[model samples]
Target: MNSTDSRASAYTTLSRDSVHEVEIKRSRFITYLFRVESEAQAREHIAALRKTHFDARHHCSAFILGPDRMIQRSNDDGEPSGTAGIPMLEALAKRDTGHGTDLSDVLAVCVRYFGGIKLGAGGLVRAYSDSVSQALEHSTLHVRQRLRIFTLPAPHALAARWENELRAAGYQLEPSVWEAAHAVLHIGIDDTEHDAGQLAAFTAALTSGAGRLQPFDTKWVDLP
Candidate 1:
């Protein structure tokens, strides 16, 4: 597939809340919290928000992204069921397509401080959803590109030259270190632009077709 066919991913925070007395705006400014590896990280975000807005009435949150959406979870805090969590979850689910296939194993939370204004169930839903939406609007999103890792082994004498050639050719090379009489090279190429013929030609020119390249797992990596 071409790069245009690639998916976009993002890192965002969940909500807006203040601990002390503060004015809250109703501009739909959800924090759009991002992917957290563990529940602990998710809680850390929650705790920090609480500390930041200690006097806020509620901190609603929802996180759904991970293996099988494995880490899916949401908290209404003190809000009515389906108001805070469900709306937040729905927002997350809507963004899943852009996140690619590995979007599972992620979490999100929306923290709301009452603002002394009661947002009814309908308003609450809009508020929660809008929070994420606003945050995403200002957030930096990245495209998740598929990369192919290859292990190339070459004699120490030719390793440095080979590495330089690959770099000059627009390939990313991992750190190469000497081991025994050979150097193991880790190379990454954008699968979307993968050209086996070009690779074979390069290898032929570099090692007279003697070098071996082993394929590794494909992964979603951040694009600059």
Candidate 2:
């Protein structure tokens, strides 16, 4: 399903691509964590890593996608069944992805650089899951906020002023547009932040009662 399919929920995921490496029994296990919106993005990352870590013996991966986590996938990449990919997936699933997040929209990969010693099934599972858990500990996460949009009208010059001040005050904004010689600014308010009267007051303060804020649409937005 598409991201839009999960409108009532927000999720937590990596703010940026992150990686960490661990050594177990002389074997190198590198974990890659990424925020992904769709299966396409997950596949792209897996393919790129396979190329980048070409010498690595395995590129086991697991991904959870969509705000509701409607899509889940895993691959062992030639490893023995139920060891690498499933544990990696579980590692990602069990963690607290952060506030207001449902732990969706993320993909994790365990790239193994085989050492002389071989880890049996149980050892392999622990290594893969541990690799992911450790990588998440070091990762920086961002919250996805489901936002309601309001289009406010302003003069061209006032648009810039309103944009700067409101954003600095921590309001989410899309780019302002010029329409019929006036600026149309789109402000995105978090689901919990919406208050019509408060917004009306803010709009008046910005435009001196010259224009008003009107309802638009709702979508997900990331906080900085």
Candidate 3:
């Protein structure tokens, strides 16, 4: 696959809502939290909770996105210097990469409820980091695959045979269409170089070297 395709192959969080909570005790100090993929989603959850518990002390948040780690932002809220947001982001970075598939985006938030106890700067960092770490341990994750899109045109009569041959050769074929007297097939190929050779062979066999294969672009796709 091309560089653009490879760069996009990183895994990302599923577009769904999930919440995880943890209780931390540092001499009467308590912290409750939730993590989501996007800042907007995280903010939505925080907004509802903040409305209900308007008196809570702090709500710290962080998020990372794209295969290249393109987007990264964190907010300490109203905690001490280097206490909440930075530690929370660090915790998420140190998290097991497997939880997010190969190339995935992740976001973490730690909501703090001061129990009338000051945990100090160091204690606050540890508490915030641990909250996210614990939540990731109980969450579900997915793996993504890179797919190359190829468009091929063959004679209408040979379309079925072409698709069957390609599938039997370990290729993923999409719906075939008949345009005039030609059959157009769309295929998805993995990153493996072997797929190119396989496609060439299949095309030669199906159209007797008369058909053409064109590869368009590559993108990250959910695994079957």
Cα-based RMSD of the predictions, in order?
A: 5.5, 4.2, 3.8
Runs with alpha carbons beyond 4 Å of true place in candidate 3:
1-8, 26-49, 99-103, 191-198, 205-207
Show where candidate 2 strays beyond 4 Å: 1-6, 154-175, 178-183, 192-213
Residue-by-residue lDDT tens digits, candidate 1, 1-224: 55554443233222232221212454223353555657778778878777876776677777765434555778888888888888777776676444353343345556554555676788877777766655555444444455667778999888989999999998887787679979988877766444545665687788887988777656656556
TM-score of each: 0.70, 0.77, 0.77
Instruction: Put down candidate 2 lDDT per residue, 1-224, tens digits, no spaces.
Output: 13335354467878888999999999999999998889999999999999999999999999998776778899999999999999999988888865745677899988999998989999999999999999999999887777778998777767788899778866778988889888898987755443545677777777778777888998877767
The lDDT per prediction is 0.64, 0.84, 0.68
lDDT at residue 152 of model 1 (Cα atoms): 83
- As for candidate 2, its clashing pairs are 12-101
- Which has the higher TM-score value, candidate number 1 or candidate number 2? 2
Error of 3 at 31 (Å): 9.3
Which candidate gets the maximum TM-score versus the true structure? 2
Q: Best lDDT goes to which candidate?
A: 2
Better of 1 and 3 by lDDT: 3
